[model samples]
Target: MDEERILERERYQIEQIRQLELEELQVEEVDSDDSDDDSSSENNYRTSGGASASGEFTYDTSLVALHSYLGDVEDTHNRLAFLDGGAVLKLPMFYLEGVVLFPEATLPLRVVQPHFIAAVEQAMTQVEAPYTIGVVRLYRDSPDYRRPPRFAIIGTTAEIRKYCRLEDGSVNVLTRGQQRFRLRRCWIDVEGATYGEVQIIREDSPLRTPREAVGRLAPLLNLRSNIFQKQPLYSPRACRLGDWDGNDSDAMSEESFESELSLHERGLHQSALFSSYHTIHEPTSSEDEKLDPDGEVHQGSSRLDNLLGPLREYNTGRDSAKSALSGNSGNLSFKRMKADKCALDRLREVPRAFWPNWVYHMHDSYTLAQKAADRWKHIVKAPSMDGFVMKPDLLSFHIASKIPVSESLRQELLEIDGISYRLRREIELLESFDRVRCKTCENLIARRSDMLVMSSDGPLGAYVNAHGYVHEVMTLHKANGLAVIGDPVKEHSWFPGYAWSIAECATCGSQMGWLFTATKKKLKPRSFWGIRSSQVADDTR
Candidate 1:
């Protein structure tokens, strides 16, 4: 019996040795494959004319080039099935605080938690669909509260585009947001990883306005152009050597020209000239009497002259002065009024179905996307606007992701599934952000142009507090209608080396933002404002 047992043990040891050898061989083969991949990539880079002596490949900076690169990255992930109303999917959940991931937006993460690492590994090993996870924002009443986090009902599906495991067993991953889903049920497993059963949210169908409505809306293109055009609305005129009509022969004497030029330089020549011309050309009473056959004015004229002669003369002088100062102001005002009336008439003539098309023509994907890209460029100090994804839904989500607003507001935007509705909301938000004001009093607070983006991300940023809750902030260099509430306190401030004080709107006495004062005197501005973007009123209407 002892000899049989010994033989069995020897056989077991031999099997173990064979298994170890196989693992070592597999490791060696993997290392060799990695080296081959590296070599192939280097050769491809060189062939593409991107190689350098420093061993770094050059990349294109244009938006078109960026879009192509991102498209390739997206193609690597498993394509998700088209979402329908009743479709249900069980996915691993990644809960985040003060973060809302929008579709088509890329989110980079460094995962170190053990449970999360396991979840990623499990996801990677899935046979049916790998590289997909559910992401939802966690919510708590306060930052310092210690309780099981409540997650948002709406969540986005994220596809892992790139991932690498580090020596310390942590993972760095880049993920792209996909379709939105609603959490039906969620539970924490024994290993502390959360899993959710979610139903896919159906996206709104694409709708276009009728051709006639589009024609009506065509005028709006010019309106948009006028709003967004980079050139000055009124060009400033420079002094010229010729006469006003550009005829050298008709030019005034040097002394008169100098007087006129001086007035022009002071921006008062036209008004003064118009007033003097009207005064010198006043009609005589004898000429007026000759025109009247009965030598008597009509009753209407007599009444009007008696009632409004003084007022009319006063207004004529004032209006003449203004008209001369701004020669095109009246014309422009008249055109604007006509345009508005025309728009209203057209709107009334068109059917309700045509309104959607009208909106589409005015806020086309390209136009809105370009506007969004321009905003990002302005915020990030980039050379030019980035290429926008072709899909309208994706484009809207992309803009929402980049906008510097509160997390709650962004989450609210994410919850809306209609493409047109989402785009309209984004447009409104963008327009309103151009000017910040108090919600209650309608007093101007700050200009969006004066916004200071302090985050490494876009203008909006999330800061985790001591208790692990996150707060989103939008920073600004200046504001109005706000008064500091108390002395600055440095404890638990979001900005390091800075103290903060509660600030309220001076007009309405409503809470607005915080006054962040530098703790160190060397900071350029001694103080600045960090307003809650959600609290600002949407005055675009």
Candidate 2:
């Protein structure tokens, strides 16, 4: 009942905004002197936002209201998922600055520009039930004006969930990211709207070292054999199997080690290599349970001890022989003792390649997932992880959507091809992402520990300006190397109870972002700094 009442109130507010837009549109029409402009305007509403005779944008004052009463609105009830199965799509492109959308993130846009408004309407009127738009980040520093604006080759497809048309013909759209894509080509149409032919990117499944590979790695992990396997008298593998009954048995041969795995086992191992190609989440079969319970092949040296229990008993006998060799007076050991100690010393000189890279615990998906979840807990305050660590693929996207980093780093995460690779990259970035610096001059601005979470989306969030430029900014409690340039203005502030002032780099005079101060006395944060992602340096590299 409470939800219904809240939804009803939202509907009322939307109707009120529509009525206000109608009145504003009527007032603009009355102020205009050209009466015949209505017929021509209706015929060319789509073309007005596009290229004109002078190759410039035709700003329509009649479409914009004096003020917008609408706040960010999203339709979560009727959400749609994109599942075309890795097919290519031709979609309308919306290039934004400092914004990189990952799958499952939400983007709110105000379509005040004529070209964008036309794009929104075109998406809505399509035959498809769920309309999708390709969103790419624009490089704001690009100086080439003759060609199209430089944008990222990689982008995310956003499905329109809800849209509201205003009286002046502008639109407010709420979209949710569905899938990632690689832009093949992009061009501007005759009506001035941009379109792109994109191929959807398919992420590889979470990785796992095969059970047969674990069996092969067992010989490398046998620490006891590593110490004394070269000795003519002491072979741990032979002693454990009763093949060495103290009659000077030779050390186990490499040919025997290779023959232990049958042809059937080798075939199974080869098939497991490409198993991740077919599906995102493969079911765990009974054979998969043979691996370590934690999915980590090498948990500790204790795991090595547990694998060689029989050899451990044999080692006890060798220890007693060594003790007997020393007299009650504790005399120096003979040649055998010296050889044993030398082999023990050689243990420290084991080649790293002998252990094999797949045995590393850090390369495991579940291990990386848990580390990422723990790191996220240390950074953010609320929202329990609740089973997120179990799904490494989902957790990778969730962290990429909200991690407080520059747009370039976020785009790198989006372009990552594998789940384990993405998680590893994120963990490395989270560990090293300490300070935010200026992108142009590399001047230190603020520490990541000083970041303030102003939104549910974490320390960084996307907010659009009056000119329809979306700036992804990170909120910080304190910042340096910045100079506030203008008096605080409360109008159109992204934060409801804050007034904003332009902020610029103190050394280079480049526009950094805005300094926001709370207008209400009761607001908890008295003041904060917003630094644009584009201006921030990509220290993750």
Candidate 3:
């Protein structure tokens, strides 16, 4: 009777999935047909070079405008424009410290420096190109901080979306990161305005099928599955696997049922679904039982246990010999070897042709965008993820922007162009971000869900100090080991009426962040904390 019920549930799930797939196909077919008609019409207009009776431009004014502003904006705007990979283009440059922009993310700037103000003005008035500037980070360790400070090579092109001139002559501008680029050469004009000749970094072709990506992420999925299994609350089979009376039927709605079933299916497939693509076979029941009960493998060890035992042992032996020769006495003598390199290489070698057809299928199967958006919603303390955009690149950049990590690590993520690679890295980061710790004392600080994105731009909040240096901070709702110093001072507070007190990590006696308390009785929550992203350790790194 139980077997029949399980089989019936599976059939029901498959039927529902098939229905959803069919609906998606219909939508795509309609979109494709409409796009074809529009393209044909556009071709006709281009050939005629005149306006149509229906008010459509025969001469491609938008294309002409894009070309006039930036030589080839139409070609590069939405799509991965570079076919052969990189191209050199001269563009106005803006330098910032401890901030890296990602594509589709927004960066807000308070332009006070004369050179930057001039750059913004130049961008605004330029008739040929759209208002765009190249953003590069100015590292403090660089030799020159005043005259064209040493900047990072990898940067992003930002399009000025909005700008306003303040009474003090400073400019407040909002810019959206468009694409990643590598700064090849930079020069400063006599007026101190900087210019960079940058090569646009092309993104990887979105050809990996959902199956292929899932296959690549098999180990991680399996690990997550095991974790979910251990935690009954998160486990999909938690209710079903236990004794349940029919009275619980009132609690199971269609949406909840679908979500549970989906999670359950994902768990089941994680262990064995991707095994056929690689040399390693599925583990036996006894071996599975013998695996780590906590579901965690050692650093640099394959999740599949003996999958690369020979290579790992060889590396282990080499490290042991080195340690013996050096007279090292601790387990630290064993350097963790990268066990995922072989797997990553294999994934990269998968035929590109297998991806394009599978792309939509994967999107339909896994719902990456929706899942990511939901996670972001919780992280940002938002009511819903509805306002968030859902494209892979956009979602990835959005999460990267809001994640409370050091600027250096964010910069590393910004430098990575491959969509899948970035998404995978982000997923790993998100997982670790759940429990933030102090870098100095490794004390537990904030949880990922406790993060509050107070700023519109990203997680990092910018504040100009009295001395005029801008500092970026990440806001958190709660933390541990923090001691508030003195009374909260309201003067020069960024949030206007709210007062702040210096907060230090109690364990190490190092400054961690600030505790802001509401002075007005109306303000809810009463108090919160803003931790410097630099002070937190990036476990992903």
Candidate 4:
């Protein structure tokens, strides 16, 4: 069986390689035809700029030659069958620095190391969910020198979308993150490849707009249901970032619910504050318009609050007395503040059936989703976001993945297991992401308004170099605190119309990113900067 599997895998790879070569040929033919028309436009643009300072910088030399990226395909057909089963899975682990993959995000990787290549081969031959691996961030605990690297417990599993084997025995693989997992334990196999026992993290159902508020949110929700008609309603048990295959509840074992039970016990929802009070008033149609739109159904009228306000004060006084019996006010106050922050970080395990009349509508998932999407539209450019807004849960991941925030902030988004909480935090980041600075020395690089959208993906994009290193960089129209090294090199440029030069921090002398100058006179922005995300810090509160 092993021998047959190996032969079968080899045959499959050969066929895929051939298909990629054919596609490359087709792309080259199309580019060649387009270049003739573009050359004339380039001449006109240079002539039009005549004698200006920017025009004087135009080069007579042609634009950088474009390189065809081979074997790039979106492979979303392969469903992860084990996720819905609630079973512990063992998968090969790949660690990267400053990378946190979210479901549905594309991650292009080049494998040259011997052990890693072997690990990929093993994944290809697996009987179940072949070509899947756990991708986790490997980072040091502190800035202290020479500290050992540690892999994060939370990670996303990536499925190899397409791959090409080079003559040098290296592999260039395009993969997409499929689902999030918790790394329970890790070990090195006999072949020196790392593997981990992982559990699928079941994310909570997204907090949706209540029926009463559905009409109020009609403008935003108009394009929601019809667009997702073909897609299945989200199931908590369904594998993320893929089509749902209806899973039976019986498939889950008792052990699968253990973590959920513990999680529910720890949550303190707003309703819990007055759970014993049974005086909630249900407003009729006549009174509906008088209802405080921000509050839930049980909070439709002030009767609920009028009955419990004094009781809450009494309980607070009693709790204060209990605290008075324990410690000094200063220490007690500080501890309480710390506890509140910690609780806010986690998802509410037990959802509130109804919130108090004083609660704000900003806490609603639909409201937060609209706010996040609106903010994103103003800052970044991408495809239509209508579908993303339809599913607030997926919108959070999509925004988190493409946002130009630092890796620390990106990792925090991945760790957040709740939808509404994630959206709220993202909105806060979008509002405060004003400046970009060097991570090591805190030197200012650029402002949020200076961001340039060069790639259709977004402002920040991942490009893999010839050396197999994937750099996630954000393009900007202007940058400061950097020195360029060596002459601009056009060879192997990720942007065909630009030549890139190595840029370093002027103050700290660390490599910040690259400065890309237009090789053709026609390219707009004559020059721009591609700052590496790993090397920069952002205002991420």
Candidate topping TM-score: 2
Per-residue alpha-carbon lDDT of candidate 1 for residues 128-175, written as tens digits (9 for 90 to 100): 447888889886654345776678999888888767677777666667
Cα RMSDs, all models = 23.8, 16.1, 26.8, 18.2
Off by over 4 Å in 2: 1-78, 140-148, 189-191, 208-360, 380-387
Estimated TM-score per prediction?
Answer: 0.44, 0.63, 0.51, 0.62
Residue pairs in candidate 4 whose N, alpha carbon or C atoms collide under 3 angstroms: none
What C-alpha lDDT values do all the predictions have? 0.53, 0.61, 0.54, 0.61
Of the two candidates 1 and 2, the one with more favorable TM-score, higher being better, is 2
How do the residues 371-420 of candidate 4 rate in per-residue lDDT, one tens digit apiece? 88888887664544556887888888888888887887888899997787
Candidate no. 2 TM-score: 0.63
Q: Could you give me the TM-score of model 1 versus the true structure?
A: 0.44
lDDT of 2 at 218: 28
lDDT of 3 by residue, 341-383 (tens): 3443453334322134445444432255555666656555442
Give the worst 10-residue stretch by lDDT in candidate 2. Answer: 45-54
lDDT of 2 by residue, 1-541 (tens): 9979976866664564454333311101111332222223332221011001122222221111212323544453555556564677678889886789988887778788877776776666555434778899887555345766668888998988766676777677778788888999988777777788888887766655422223332222223454444442222232222121222232334356435545555344323422321232233332331323222223233423333332333455466566766643223334544554554444323321213445544556777899888887776543334468988888898888878788888989988887878998988888888988888888888787777766655666667676667777787767776766545676676665556778777778778888776554444455667889878888853
Q: For residue 123, what is the lDDT in candidate 1? A: 69
For residue 338, give model 3's deviation from the true position in Å: 49
Query: lDDT of candidate 4?
Result: 0.61
